[model samples]
Target: MTAMALTQRPASVLSRLLHRHEACRGWLLLAPALCLMLVAILFPLGSTLVMSTWSLDGYSVDRTPTLGNYSAMLGQPMFGALIGRSLVVATIATVVTVALCYPMAYFVAFHVHRHKALWLILLTLPFWTSYLLRVFAWKVVLGYEGVLNTALIGLGIVQEPLAALLYSQTAVTLVLAHSWAAFAILPIYVSLEKIDRSYIEAAADLGDGLTRRFWRITFPLSLPGVVAAFFMMFVPTVGDYITPAMVGGPDGMMVGNLIQAMFGPMNNWPAGAALSVVMMLTIGLAGLAFLAVGRLVGR
Candidate 1:
């Protein structure tokens, strides 16, 4: 009897609390996640903001609050060019990766009724091998006397290996696209898979062709995944330092490489912080604009 009374008392208390504030339970449930984001994301961002305002004094950091770091970053023409280059490379990679992966994703989502889990495992298998190893393999393949050159020479397609394959902007873009393909494909596949088959069947019953049905039902429903994939691919690729450094030679240098230099031999943490802040803000604005445009188009 006493045990039953205790449980009932708690239930009554919870009911009263819930009745008093409809949103309180929801907010309570979300508090842990919000706290986690505050610790992991907001704290680092706040620290970076604080660091960016510090002045650079000779070889050491000046704790004095000043906007010199931002002023210095804006003063450099090369900085602007690097940022532009990063955007261009990241965009190209995003587009190409999505283009290549979408058909495969579509195939798996629609045609492959059996071994669906196997296909997904295979898709992600390449990543299980270290990312650095894949880049290095590409480097070897693109080298002047590497496997590609050897195969081409053996086939008599060309008298000499192409010197232009490695350490260029083209190489950088290709490597980035390859590296990030899985990220793009999985999201899109999930989106396509989530779509109700009834919608497609209904469209077909209404005398719609395959193309019409896809355009009307499947494509629109899959866009949320596409948008999510785009952000996932674009944001990280822009900041990728290792791939660009390993295969991207002199011409392939992006803003990430520059940021790395600023922190490394240059010993300009404040300037790096400033550059990072601007880059983050630019990416956030671009993402917002993309979503805005998507919403308008959807309407």
Candidate 2:
């Protein structure tokens, strides 16, 4: 009986300790994920930050810490321009994707009574194919003498194919918006679907019109999803090199392209790492600003 009591006493003390430290217990529950993130995310980020501080020597890494890479990045106007272009392209794509997808999500949430799953499946059908294939399709469509140009020419709208349609910032934006449409739509639909109809119905009962009810109750509640969509779209788009490489000609070349060049043909890993750090910091700051704006709007 004394032995059993002693064992139970430790168990009870442990239980009480855990109960007192709810946050500690929660962290224990999340330990696996935290460890994985520490290994995968933090380790790589720390390596990159360390690499950013190093410089390249002739045919070898100097392995000496220096701020020259960051200094050069700041002193150079070209880097700033590319980063700005990336931000603009990403921002425009995010806005266009969200704006276009919101109505579709709203329709699926509010109007689709039968086979909601089917509607969602249909909405996501375009994403079934590989991302590259979709981007290539856009390229074919936007190319000079492509389908759009051919159709317009046949309709007598123009004598020649519009060269501006492809290999431009606009082209990059269009491709990005098309690529991320599903990502923006799903979250928004989920948010709208989860909204209690009672609030909207009450607004209607109070003589509120559709727009008023949407602005007053529906939109505010869905701001979380909207904010999530914006973040998901904006972050990846800013660092997108593939779309820009394929279609973003010289004028549309972004920071991602430069970073790729630095690591690839240029073989300047340290500089690339520095640029990567700057890009990550820029995205973080932008995300914070966007989140703040979303919170303000929600209020």
Per-residue lDDT of candidate 2, residues 1-299 (tens digit): 99988777756766888889999899889999999999999999999999999999986998889999999987889999999999999999999999999999999999999999999999998899998999999999999978999999999999989999999999999999999889999999999999999999999999999999999999999988899899889999999999999999989889999999999999999999999999999999999999899988888
Judge candidate 1 against the unseen true structure and give its global Cα lDDT, from 0 to 1.
0.90
lDDT of 1 at 296: 75
TM-score winner? 2
* TM-score for candidate 2, residues paired by index: 0.90
Query: Clashing residue pairs in candidate 2, if any?
Result: none
Itemize residue pairs with steric clashes in candidate 1.
none
lDDT of each candidate versus the true structure: 0.90, 0.94
